[model samples]
Target: MRITEVEIHEFDYEVARTGTVGGNWVYDPDSTLEPPGFVLTIRTADGTEGHYRGFAFTPPMIAQVTMVAEEHLLGRDPLERRGIWQDCWRALRHTDHFGLGAIDVALWDLAGRHYGESVSGLLGGYRDTLPTYASTMFVDDSGGLDGPDAFADYAETCLDRGYDGFKFHGHPDVRPDVDIAICEALAERVGDEMALMIDSSSLYRTYADALRVGRALDDLEFFWYEDPMHDGGVSERTTKQLATTLDTPMLGLEHVRTGPYGTVDSLAGESTDLVRASAHMDGGITGALKTADAAEAFGTDVELLLGGPAHMHLMSALRNSSFFEHGLLNPESTWILNQGFEGEPESIDDDGRMAVPDGAGLGVEIDWAFVERRRTGHTLID
Candidate 1:
């Protein structure tokens, strides 16, 4: 079927907080926060519509979506996913092409609906459930995860909840010694019962700092060391050096572009022991699958970043990958975004495994009323 129209809806959602300690999208220390979310609907002439939601949209990202919808996606066949993906890739080659991913994802959702299947099934379903880890929020000084003992206590709570693994989103102060102390404390608390990992979020300022922290992780027998030093995990030589220096596997390239091509280059350079794939960041499902397959070819696992319906599908299908990240989680905040769902809002089972939605497409049924109430603006291209 051919596409007849595209609609973009921008909305605001209240978040407990609006900044990340490090990695991509780190907010300024004093920046005023007005977080934005968007939903794009591609409606076909025959009345088949594909819907996709994107969180944390910048002004440029919103503009890119509008441009792509008006110029490239208005009348194309929704079934021509690969061709559409390639066209969008070329259309915005000069830029990182952030908005292309949302459109590509919506197209995949449409494809799944048209075929009466789930996206995971379309991508070759491997499993129905995935073990998940408790990925914590950045350490705060506000009496919530403020210190090492607090983190260890939280780890114990997660273990009691049935999580097989836990990951710390360390403090943003770039203190390697503090990070090491936290790691050691966590190991002492629940290392025997849970596999632990850490995402420094690129906080460490120097190779020496990262090396020192890496050695501590090696001693604690942590699962992986992620985005350890600065340079935003983009320096192949430096990452390679870190990987060679540490026994703990380095998971890098979470912020790189070009999906599989960039991942393959890093692999060839021996920069990372493992690769990272995110459907949202890596050109939607198409690019993420390419990265996963490339990682497979190299005899390594691809840890898909973030948590969502799309990530659950990828994790279910990929054999090399392990543990879904139930992230940015904290005691005071709720991760639930959508309301009026039948099962648990977060998609996590009582056994600590993430369950794939069995419904068609992404398998998520949105509460349109809730979304409409939150709408700040809308744009329609016909």
Candidate 2:
């Protein structure tokens, strides 16, 4: 089917209470500005349409992307999805193409709809139900020290609901001490009954700091350490520290871009464990698949991060794919209003597993009413 129209939807929700911290490494908010959420809609000539969502962006950015892509996509074949992904990415390299991940997701969904197949099948189907883990970010007003208690509460809730594993945001300012405490408490609370992971979000500030945190988590038998340091320069250093200093595996590459592969090669030099591939951020299915292959050459395993349901489809099918990052707080209320599966922790299986959408093309249905209700200004393109 050919693309008849493309529409971009931007929405906002009143910030009720900001309990969780920002995913960005450097975060300092005086409690004034609210975060934005963006979602996109693409319609094909045959009357089939697809929807995809993303977090932490402004309406102007979403509008800017829609303006650039509407011209490129409108008379093209919706089935030619990979080509659509490449062209859009190549054209937007000079202007923060990372923000364009939502478009890549929309294109994949479009192709799935046109071919009447699940996105997972296209990604090379492996299993229907992929085990998932809870990643928690709840913190009390005390800043960071309250994390351990909040984590304990959250973990227990997930466990009660049937989840097998859970992860917590481990960082310094958020309570470096609390990070240690939570890992220790979690190990004690669940023991081998659940798998545990810690995401530092590169909050350690220095490589040495990351090393200390990694060692602590390793002692606690934590699964992996995420983004201990954001800079590529220290990636190998940090990975080596984790491998040697601590047995904890380093998991990241979520915000990584496609490039010379030098950093990835260095990290895999008996230092790193898994390269976290975010299909949304790293281009799309085609680009992500390429990244996965490159990691294989270096003997680094690919652990895909499912930012949401759309990515979950691909992660379920990926052979080398590991687990997904499930957001605890609704960064963007409108982003998931219409998609299947409520944001409730229970949507994930008791064993922390997810079943691939069995129906055609991502197996997700859009709730236009929800979309229209949240629409800020632009109309849903027919």
Candidate 3:
């Protein structure tokens, strides 16, 4: 189907809980909790739509994305996902790649709608159920919880809930040694029961600092590290340094956008063990799929991160997939708002795994009225 129109929506969602890591602090010292997230939605000409939930983006970022989409994707085939993505990248490279992802996701959502297939089907098909890991974000203002206790409690909860593994996002301002000690306790408490990982979230300011932490975690035998540093801004020399010094894999670059025609290397080279590919944030289905392959070429795996039905839909389809990143975000809005799987996946599984929705494309078709009811502003090209 030829594309007729593209629509984007920026809406506000509630935040029931807030999380803190040692390196990055989202918890306002003066506040009670973290702020709600910003979500985006895309609609195509044929009337099909897709959903994207992420951090509240700035006006300039949103505008930059819309401008690129308008210039390059007004009347293209919704199914020629890749070609259309290339057009956006080439057209918008002048603006420093501006949210190249938002536009790509719009197109992919359009394609899934057109094919009447789940976003996962568009990628290589995989097991219906995959393992899920719990990512806890806690802002411990009360100080009642320590790193080890926090990790143990969360990991045990994941085990009780049937999840296969668990990850803890450390308090941004907390000491690295404190965070490491927490990981140590978590490893000891549930090592045999489940896999464990830690998110430094750019806690280490220098490559050596990161290396020291990575080596410590390696001794702990954790799965892999998450976002030890930021994207291209993180020095390649540093990446090489960390890579050589640490046995554990480094994971990140979640902020890169999907290409109308660009590759992962075009954005960031293979410096990590795992790259986060959000179908919604990475240009929807089309751009995400290609990037998954590129990640594999660089010997990196794809961690399908973030919220929404679209994420589960994409995870179900990826061949070289990692775990479904399950976090309890605004459950009051998302789960209460969603007509799909009620509340999160049933549990991890008997095999210590979790699966995707068994239904058709995207599995869950969200109610647009619910979205429109909460609509804050337009993100699409009219």
Candidate 4:
């Protein structure tokens, strides 16, 4: 069946609090706060529709999705995902590929619905459940996760909750000594029972600083050290040096622009011990899978970067990847994104594992009533 219509819905959902590190958004210091959400709906001639929700949506991104859907997607078979993705990629070559990713995932959702199987099954399911780690939000002045002792206490809480792993997103202004203290505290607290990791988020200003932190992690036998320095995770030379200097394996390339090619190049350069792939950032599931295959070929593991159904599907299919990241978590507030989904698959169970929904498509049930209540604007392509 051919796609007959495409609808873009924009809405706002309140977040409990804003997370800041060094006077900026913790994720991207330069970027503005993102709009709540953008939901894309692709309709077929037979009345079946595919839906996908995107994070950090902006006006330009919504416009790009609209243009791509109207220009290259409408009237094409939804099942021709690869062709559509390629065409959209070429059309938007001068722009960010997030729009292409949004449409591509929607198409996959449609295909899953058509086949009456979950997206993971469509991608060749390997397992129904995945071990998950609680990825914490950046440190704040608030008493919640402010210091090393606080962080250790939080790790104990997570361990009690059945998490097998805990990853800390430290404050941006934190120094090497403080970083080392946090690492040591965590290792002393729960390191034996749980796999511990640290994501500097590229806050360290020098190789020496990163090396210091890396050496501490090595002493503690941490799982991985990520985005260690201010090079923003792009410099193959710096990453290679850091990997060589430290015993802890480096996980890099989360911010790299090119999809599978970038991952393969970093692997070939021996810059990273483990690679990172996000369905949202890596050109959707297609790009993520390509990177995964590349990592598999090199005998390296590709860690899925974020939590979501799409991410869950990719992690479930790939054997090399280890744990699902339940991220930006905070003690003061919940991590709920929207009230639209009937089931929240991202929530970790008592075993610290997340299960993939077995229903058709992404297996997510959207609450249209909630969407309509929250919607601020809409666009339709026919």
TM-score of each: 0.93, 0.82, 0.80, 0.94
Native-referenced Cα lDDT, model 3: 0.59
Q: Which ranges in model 2 have alpha carbons more than 4 Å from their true place?
A: 14-16, 20-34, 58-64, 142-145, 171-174, 230-244, 259-271, 329-346, 379-382
The sequence of per-residue lDDT tens digits that candidate 2 reaches over residues 1-382 is 6777767666554343343445432112333233555567778766787767655445545754665665667788777766776787777776655645666777778777777888887777778777677665444444432546656666777777666678776653545666778888888887577788877765666666667677788788887777667573245655666666677777765555642253366555655667766656666566666667777777666766545656677666566666665654322212222242333322556456665666777677654565566667564443
Clashing pairs in 1: none
Question: How accurate locally is residue 266 in candidate 4, as Cα lDDT from 0 to 100?
Answer: 92
lDDT digits (tens) for residues 36-94 of candidate 3:
33344555555766544444343545766667655566666656666766776577666
Q: Give per-residue CA lDDT, model 1, range 1-382, as digits (tens).
A: 8999998877766544335444322223343334677777888999998877776444556677777776688789998988988888778777777777788888888888999999889988888888999988777665667779989998998988889899987777676777788899999999998989999987788888889899999999999999987788888899999999899999998777678888999998899999898777678888888889999999999998877777877777898998888876776654434432334535567787888877788888655675688778888889
Provide the clashing-pair count of each candidate structure.
0, 6, 30, 0
RMSD in order of candidates: 2.7, 4.3, 4.3, 2.9
lDDT, each prediction: 0.80, 0.62, 0.59, 0.82
- Candidate 4 positional error at 177, Å: 2.6
Rank by lDDT, highest first. 4, 1, 2, 3
Segments of candidate 4 deviating more than 4 angstroms = 22-35, 57-60
Cα lDDT, model 4, residue 307: 79
User: How well does candidate 1 score on lDDT at residue 18?
Assistant: 39
Residue 188 error for model 3, in Å? 1.2
